[model samples]
Target: MTAITINFNNVLKLSDDQFYQLCRDNPDVKFERNAFGELIIMSPTGGETGKCNASMTADFIIWNRQTKLGEVFDSSTCFKLPNGSDRSPDVSWIKLERWNALTSKQREKFPPIAPDFVLELMSPSDSLSETQAKMQEYMNAGVKLGWLIDRKTRRVEIYRQGQQKEVLESPTSLSGKDILPGFVLDLLFV
Candidate 1:
């Protein structure tokens, strides 16, 4: 089979529902828009490209969930930011009761709400400025907590409501103090 060449300049259009439905059929595709509406498609990172780093993120979220603490979502989905923009975080968690507050339809939509916490790990192709901007947007939109995980640096930039930005390295615990009680993410070594 011939490889498909992606022309980033071309416009890619889809309604929010179209994008959600696409996810069900093709979990391997990742979508993002440029300044224009062109939806850039790339194979979702996996195997070696998505190895240790992404899995570390998964491990953290899973630990929280298995402890029956929260629900987690990965980059296989997108979200509506309060500023009327859309974004995809590497991993996120919604406090159980708050998430269950959604109507069936609301749950089916773009989740119309922010996660109690979000974790974004840098892929090889991700840009620092872009990822940081995303974390800021999430916080400004009332997201209680956010983490920008640097795979290459093995650190995370932690964000919280009404606080200064703090970069944490190893041996520090990632906490959801206000948003998630009894939650401590000890992912320094990861």
Candidate 2:
């Protein structure tokens, strides 16, 4: 199923702590909040999608381990963006310096910083328009690099700060470029 969005800005507004508590209270539910304070209830991915996500996350983890230049996070980690939105990408990374800058509490809770790189792997239930909008939000919130990968279509859209997004069709791989030197994503396995 696609995500369900609830607009409660008129009747009630949830503070950051309230949102966190809501998530904590509902451990089975995956949640996100838009900049406008709307709540998005996300469904769990199917087996194939979950497998793809795991593989991609593992790739990031391995790369980060070798480089030691950043920390890699899986889909479960929600981040509080500068635009007041709480988002969780399929995979994300933060520069070592930027991650070290966070207070212990901030790191313990929803991180209050944008990731240096973000990746969104579209599941069957995901809406392309909504995912694209989310990617734009990440870029606006200072994400240096982002990727929107559509496994079904075998297409990828690359987002970079201060540059228009580049779309690749059935590419064999993706380069991290200057943002993640020596990092290349092998789309063949994905």
Candidate with maximal TM-score: 2
Candidate 2 regions with alpha-carbon error over 4 angstroms: none
Q: Per-residue lDDT tens digits of candidate 1, residues 1-190?
A: 1112244344656666765676567766665533334455644554543665566566666677667777788776577655655566777888788788988888776777778788777666666886787788889878888888775677789898899999877535676676766667666445
CA-lDDT, candidates in order: 0.68, 0.96
TM-score of 2: 0.99
lDDT of 1: 0.68
RMSD of 2: 0.7
Stretch of 10 with least lDDT, candidate 1: 1-10
